[model samples]
Target chain A: MALKRYRHDWLYSFCSVFSMIAFMVPMLTVLGIKDGIVGTLTRRLLENPRNREISPIGTRAFRPEFFEALITHPDAEFLVPETREISATMNLIAEGYPSFDGDLYSSAPGDPLLSETLDPQALSHQLALGEIYVSQGVAEKLGLSEGSELTGRVGRRQGARNEYGRLPLKVMGVIPRHITPKYNVFCSLDLARMTEDFRSGYAVPELGWKGKEKGSEIPVYSRFRLYSRDLDGVERLRLHLLGLGVDTLTQAAQIKLVKDLDHSFTVVFLALFVVVGGGAFASAASGSIDQVVKMRRSLAVLALLGISKLRLLVFTMSQAALTGFLAALGAEALFLALAKTLNSYFGGSMGAVEEVCSLSAFKLVAAAAIIVVFMTAASGCAYTSLADIEPSEGMRDV
Target chain B: MDPSPQKTKNGAKEASPPDPDVSDDVILNCADLVKTRKGGVGYRLLVESMTIGRGEHLALIGDSGSGKSTLLDMIAMVLKPDSAGDFSFRPIGHAKWHDLWKIWRKGAYGIFEALRRSELGYIMQTGGLLPFLNVADNITLPADLKPGFPKAEKRERFKALTATLGISHLLGKLPSAISVGERQRCAIARALIHAPSLVLADEPTASLDPPTADRVFELLLDLCRDSALVVSTHEQNRVLTGRFKVWRIDCRPGGEGQPIEARVAPLKDRAPAAALPAGRVSLAKSLSDSVH
Candidate 1:
């Protein structure tokens, strides 16, 4: 025997190992690429489920704790969407100020809507109790620019029966032009709460600058977002919140449908590869067993020496196991390399670099297990020959 | 004993162990043993009341279509006999047939395999040593399978026999590198390694030259000193009645063929160590090197 290679009988065994590896690489890589695309897109969508999904159902008259409980999840958004709406009348002169109905885009600091490159501190303040970014259309009509002092108010559509006054404000930068929809006027949700449109209390405090207590009627939000950790957890969280009588909505159903699609694809690929890879392994193992039968003299000698047919079969099993293990090793390396190359080529929005490319450890194990089962079953095909061997029969052929 | 039996002019002595109190007990007892397989003209074989005891030898001879090898296979338990009016081996201290039957009901091969490992030895014609193992490993192969391993006494006997067969120096070399004579020597050593009660040889010296064949045949006699040895060969001329009791089988051709018929014969040499009186070739000094 050479240092690296096995002796004559095992030479067939080594060739089988290489053939199994070659078969495994291309099949596993193709399946891995599909999984990579689905997983990455799914991850990006799941990162911000609350907004893309409609606001979770909530009651009109729940205690403040209701919103607080929803806030417990990291990505939950508790918005009063009604506050973002207003009818702007620029002035109360004989000729009213030029006005347009528009929405205020207010959010929590890490809202997916926030630009990714914004300075962290300013970004946090911009979500609430800070200067506002106005839509380009709104800025053009209002003739507003960054650092311009501006007055804010509850427009008459908020109500004609109440005596509420405009509040002072400054226009911050215009919303980045690249983000869609140019007419939005962004502000802090805290600021939005001061508008007469949200106030339902008895005394509107003379409207110089009404503190939260003077307004006293807790604002009811038209919509809110409640984020959970992952797609599987979303359903559980939704059920619990629903048990507490809060109406909720999320991308949970859509996400589940997408996930089901992904899972179905994975199962199909697994079945396909098992048939292809397992067939390859079975063929290799059968050839090796035939070689063992061809070496029947050696087998008969062992039998005469009292080695039972069952005991001698261990060598065949080990040959299969060795080939399966090496093929798994080669397949994983090739799958990972293929994933990296494809991810880099497609780049961010179009490709999922980390999530979709590399095969999961679970998949690698399953592929190996399938190959081994096929090989073991194939090796058993030689049992009749082994059982037939005898010392006298070996002599006859010699 | 046949008075016309002849002997060879070789100076080889009957090789038996050095022990003084060797027991002479019956080793194999069988009558009307029959075996048949489908689709062959050499279909059936029947043996009537063949008995061999320890420290004895039996030679089997037959025409090409007769059942010499088939009988040897049945004796070795490598093939099951279809019918045996009575068949038993009286290996001392072994399991009773009834108990072995209990094991057989679960799996027949298990019983055969266990018995082969524990009691029977087989020597194939081509020196069937495994190509991967060295001479020493091949010689000790049976010993290794034995449970309470090293079977100290058996190991010592193996060492002694290998030494006698002139294979002790080649113990570390693989079968592929050894000469045919040396490989045959190892096969002989392996058969005797466990000191089995019976040793079945199927034309064991057919691979060797004549002189080497004689030497190996003599060594087999030396090693199976206490065994009931059954050897199958086609050469009637080499049979020595003083050493071997011969049985010949022949099945004549017919449209459907006749059942195998067997008979016994004697081959004479010059004389057998002064144990028997002079005759022709001893009935002859060599049965005229007969062919039949």
Candidate 2:
């Protein structure tokens, strides 16, 4: 009966549904666009390995145990001890290119910078004493390739005489240009420490280069290479390091920007939803009252025929819910169409991977459910009018 | 023993006794049922004693504002009487009789509504068919309300009933599209669809012309032969026929701020032509003046 009555008054039903859709579409569109922008920015921020790196700003003495304990931290992903920056530099000589100076760093398995290019386990096995990996700039300038041999010179001035020791280096592979664009070379920690010791005039046997013999002393590193598992982990580890009186560099500002934008968009969306949803509710309630008043005689006849009051209430609410559901469906369709058009028109500027407007299926379903419930509650206001109607009214009034 | 009106001390007439044959077959019995309406001129309707027997047709004849419709509404349970005395109903095959006044006082509306749906039907003067439903749906509405009624049986009855009333062709049309006489026929069909134990119709043919009124009224009478019927109408010529037991309401104007009194009593001497006068709207006035 509810369905029949709704269908009988098709014009009124159409107008009611159209009005609801008018309020719903703009709110949904705004929510979708906000989600799109925030989602794209967060995705881009998380995709880069550089944002996850947390390196100390200046040289600090860190023992081997310090590296071990730091690696076990909850936010720590990977760590490798490094020598002093002065000793870490190497002068390279290749067959065709002139002597080029490059900054060298110690590396190990599971380094986040090399995760995509080389398998961690394979890299762990391949990090031999003489093997080294060069950055794209170094590889391009020196005309170096895998299995190519080069000379790495480590020199020191003892009192008056300048002494130099050279080691033969094999190019293991070249890191991608985008990963590390500077002239940098990567070697095993043992090899890098040996160079430092040689430069300090304390190594003699490992490379057969002449140097002073050192007494037994505990080893310490000037710096360390540290990385976190993700962007949020980077910020957490940085804060922990700051608490330990270590200042670190990380991309926290960019992350904060994206988060603030997300929060602001959510606030705006909620405000708009409240205002528009309230208006729609008021309109729907008025429509329900008018319809109830208009059909009082027919309802009274139903009462005269012994239809229960509960059943009459059910009929009224069911009709409202059905109309609301149809309106929500229409609104969703319109939103999808509009989103497609908006994405196509503006997505070109955001590149191939990101859209200008997008929403999740879960949110759309939740919104539709809310609309139906609101409409049902609005119709409940008319139940008082229904209860006041007496079956004698049908007999008396035309 | 003459079964005539008897003069009382206040110049009012007392009611006569019920027929012995109908006393045994009584379906509805009422006594001292009074309803009062207060206004600038207050009005009160009083029924001293009345009985409606099973399968018996009764007509209430009165002028306008003579409390005819009010009495029907009260009997139909749409309007609650201010006070009732000995108002009881017993349907056929039901061993327990229902006390109408007790049911109202106890707030047991469900029981009353059940009885109304199962045993009583009503026809309003305007042929109150729902505007949204077509004639066929309107006629079959009462049967639909009865739970566990077989659909196929209802369909068969619907076919036979509409065919009998000569409205089978107009079944698909709405009430607005149908003629006034046709809508009245559909109302009759709706009232009798469940084959209730009693039917109450208030001025069923008041809005129709003479020829159409005769046809619609005859259809109502023919269809309701098995159910006890209490119809209120102003058509005195039709009531003069011998098929119905006639009752008349006589009202007397009261003084200022006093309630005008109306009484329900059966007419005596139905066999004689001169006993009951036939007029347009003066039946109640003539009866009141003649009795006084």
Candidate 3:
């Protein structure tokens, strides 16, 4: 029966093939790309060193009272009590100095630099103790190399201190260009502590038996970075530190902002895919079902002549499968064409690009199955209803 | 013919009184049949208390919507009364006597069942031959669906029948490609292929020209020689005399709340007066003579 019908209606057969192709190609492409992107992003995030950190900032400035409590609270890891002034500034240095490069800020404490770029004769003019890394922009301007040295001057501070006011230090290692601009200049904790503007005046002696006394004035600042193993745990700790006269930003706040952005983008991408691909498949299926309904009378005659319902169903399913297969093929061709056009337009962006259209065997098979199921199910239901119609009723129409 | 009559009488004499065996002559029996149709306005009684006998031709004459077709459908087992009275039939064989009742109860059984029973046939008003099938296939459709007889035998019968109808040349053409008269002939061929005990035709000559309609009716009467025939028609002159039992259905108000009534009467006995030379009967005279 199917053979007989197919031999007579080539147009219907071709339509079936075309509908399948249209339904499958885009569905597969979208599924594959989404899976690939999510997998790649997750892997990159998990492998990064920052993902392991409990908190990126030191605990002391985050919540002073919590830090004090933690020092005696048994769960604390390192209990060396210390205080420092934190500040942010943008600086520029001569381009040729090796130690003056922007990369100096990202390096560890022992990184080497060019002595010729710095005043090596004076210890106070050497690289500051603890790690001192300069910003990438400053490194480029200073023409800094790994071993370069240069003069480092304290910049403006919001809080006042009288201990070591407005002093200069030796240039340090240049930070790598890959580091983000926000953390471009990374000075040692000791260096930030030494600057007079960082000290709370009426400065007392440094912790120990005997130390120098500076002044009695205290500085007030509104912002600080809090670091902890548990991001939310540290925020809870932050409130305690606030009672100790320190203000801080918790990792929880930063995480919330990042999550919101990620969720918003994911939803937008999915909505766009559904609106375009879903609508196209639906329209194609609708047209195919209408054609099937139009052929109901002929099918009814066939049913009366002794074709079983199951065989008729299979015939109808074959029609849908053919349409879906063709549609999938057409969709693939369209995707390929678009890929070619895109590659021609923006191939240079990817640096030595080849073919842009990537057809994976797995994706193709999955899409084909989906197309077949969708088309077959839609047309099968319609065919079943039509097949059950009595031939007497059909003749009445005549 | 005299010896055959003596043998038939002798056979009837030998049969026991109150015989359970069905007589070969009695084919169809409808006792107190009734039919009703539901329209937008209300229910309309189409047929009431209609009965037909074996090898007997019946022409149901009535006006439009007067239930002629509905009566044919009821007798053809295509429609069942809303509340049926008793309908019984002794088909060609004893085994088929019970099967006919089963087929009648279903109202619309598969066409194969009718072919299997060989108890009833129908020539639809519009000549219902499947468009895809050629004249030959249309005539041989019943045998093809249910191969009860040998292929060669069936083929021989089909050839002979088509030749008698002068449509042998059209055997290879589809029904759609043929003229309406040829199509009607083919429909008659199809209905007679199995040699059913009863043939019910609904307006079999409706689409034919007057001459063609007369020829078609003659063919129907010829075929009715071995089977009972009930045809629905509105033509007054086509009623068969002496050979058929005429029944006219009237859809008018009657006494005691009866809205429809069937007036059955034996065809007038004009056979002796209609003796004519061989092959010399005028077409109109022959039609009127066969259908009075």
Instruction: Encode model 2's per-residue lDDT on A214-261: one tens digit a residue.
Output: 777788998887888877898889988899888998888888888899
lDDT of 2 at B243: 80
- Name the top lDDT candidate: 2
Best by TM-score, which number? 2
Candidate 1 stretches greater than 4 Å from native: A1-7, A50-52, A56-192, A196-219, A232-275, A333-356, A384-392, B1-24, B37-44, B92-107, B134-136, B151-161, B168-174, B237-241, B245-258, B263-292
Model 1 scores a C-alpha lDDT of 0.62
Model 2, position B194: C-alpha lDDT score:
82
Question: lDDT tens digits, residues A332-389, model 3?
Answer: 6776666556556655565423333344567666666676676777666565466555
How accurately is candidate 1 docked according to DockQ?
Answer: 0.26
* Interface RMSD per candidate (angstroms): 4.0, 1.3, 4.9
The 10-residue segment with the lowest total lDDT in model 3 chain A: A107-116
* lDDT, residue A213, candidate 2: 93
- Fnat of candidates, each listed: 0.46, 0.38, 0.00
Candidate 3 accuracy as TM-score: 0.49
Q: Give the lDDT of residue A219 in candidate 1.
A: 64
| Candidate 1 C-alpha lDDT tens digits along A1-398 | 11111344456656776777778777777677666766665765664443244454532444456677666655444333423233222221111346554565555565444543246675565454446667666766677777766665553322456544565556656655434245765666565555534243323343454433453556656544444545666666667767876667766666876778688877887787778757885687567567577767777766665667788676555556666676677767776777777767665656334655556789878978876766666666767666677645644544
Candidate 3 residue runs with Cα over 4 Å from true position? A1-373, A380-391, A394-398, B1-28, B38-59, B88-122, B129-178, B182-200, B215-230, B236-247, B255-258, B262-292
lDDT per residue, candidate 3, B192-217, as tens digits?
77677778777787778989998999
Best by DockQ: 2
